[model samples]
Target: MLHLLTPDEIFPSLPEVDLERLQRRGVRGLVLDLDNTLVAYGGREAAEPVLVWLREARAAGMRLCILSNGRPRRVRLTAERLGLPWVESYTKPRRRGFRAAARLLGTRPHETAVLGDQIFTDVLGGHRAGFVTVLVNPVSRRELPHTRVVRAIERLVFALLLRRGRIDREAWRLRTS
Candidate 1:
């Protein structure tokens, strides 16, 4: 169970992710979380840097999809603004959404990477679905009530991992150049 929640990589932000490195590893697709992962919670649009990265990633021949648990309208609107496909109101920590995102990207699980801010939902779901997982710090501390509760648990888990030296806090905090 703990292993399922463990992310394969941790980064300070989405922009820090090395798309070229992922490509070298044969990751041809990306399944991204919408809210804190790409922008602040309740944000209706992607930030300029995110848009630039998305353009670059697409140009590099990577398929992308927004897989989010947000309301359908919000998700769809955001996706349209970013000019990307999306699966809204997706129930994470469940394999179905991850699988569906993979299908939408036209990539098998092994050839895809799931990037998000939540460990329990994004990491667990992606791991369970056999996709690589990248966990990024949330863009904002504000989140939904239920997500706040999960964040508490996530902190505890992160503390334990830190104590065991399984993760490097400073390394994960390094800002992208």
Candidate 2:
């Protein structure tokens, strides 16, 4: 049960993800979380570095899809700017949305990776769907009130996981390259 919340990999930020390493590990597709993942909370567009990372992934022949819980118009606009397909208002932590994103990417769960900032949502849903899960630090300190509450719980769990050695420090290092 606790393992479901554990991410397969962790990166300081989205741009820090090593595309080459993911490719070597058989991740041919990516299902991305929008808010505080690709874009900062309440931001209109992805930063230049994020854009570059997406471009690099595309150039490497990786399929990408945005699965956002945000409003339809916001999600659609962001997806359009990113030039990626999207599943809007996709309540995360649900297997349905994750699987839908996988189908949209035309990739099997094993071939897909999900990247996001929240453990309870993105990591849990990705694990439930049998896709590789990557967690990144939230791009902004600002977030919704409900999310702030969840973030507190996330911190506790993360510490416990670290103390118990459930997190693989070596795998964390492996991603740096």
Candidate 3:
């Protein structure tokens, strides 16, 4: 079955995340989601938190790349300015995007982690492609209208999980690799 994990389980608290722990988890590469996961939809650049995370990840011998269902303009601009590799117009829940990102990482799906803001697309797609899926809270609520709808679905699922006690606040971790 597809695993349901909250942001805390997937990445630890944003403040507590570190490259060393990720390395211990055997994640040598990362394919990060844009927009809400990294920044808001209207975000013009990576925020300070994201910048710090990127630096730490790189410093710990981890590679990073951008993969999103967003336009080439946003992806390219961010990727270029950050000097990181990326795949724009990358369709999630599809192997193409994950495959491209895997190629860029020079790592197999099993060794890579896909961090994102949605479950249906980000988690499902990453799971399908065989990468470890990490779900995170969206940074802001100002997402595209379509994303808002998906988020509504997520809330319903989260509520169900909460009722069933499937959500573990202390040990927020799920792995398919």
Q: Alpha carbon lDDT of residue 149, candidate 1?
A: 97
- lDDT scores of the candidates, listed in order: 0.86, 0.88, 0.72
lDDT of 1 by residue, 75-137 (tens): 998898888899864678798999999989999999999999998888988999999998888
Model 1 pairs whose backbones collide: none
After superposition, candidate 3 runs with Cα above 4 Å error: 4-8, 12-16, 169-177
Best by TM-score: 2
Cα lDDT of model 3 by residue, 13-121, tens digit: 2324555766777888888888777667768677787778788788788888989888888778877887788986456778789889999899988888888878877
Looking at model 1, residue 145 earns an lDDT score of 96
TM-score preference between candidates 1 and 2, better one: 2
**C-alpha TM-scores of all predictions:** 0.92, 0.93, 0.85
Can you write out model 2's per-residue Cα lDDT over 83-140, one digit (the tens) per residue? 9999974568888988889889999999999999998999999999999999898888
From the highest lDDT down, the ranking of the candidates is: 2, 1, 3
Superposed by TM-score, candidate 2 places the C-alpha of residue 118 at a distance from the truth, in angstroms, of: 0.1
- Candidate 2 clashes between residue pairs 3 or more apart in a chain or in different chains: none
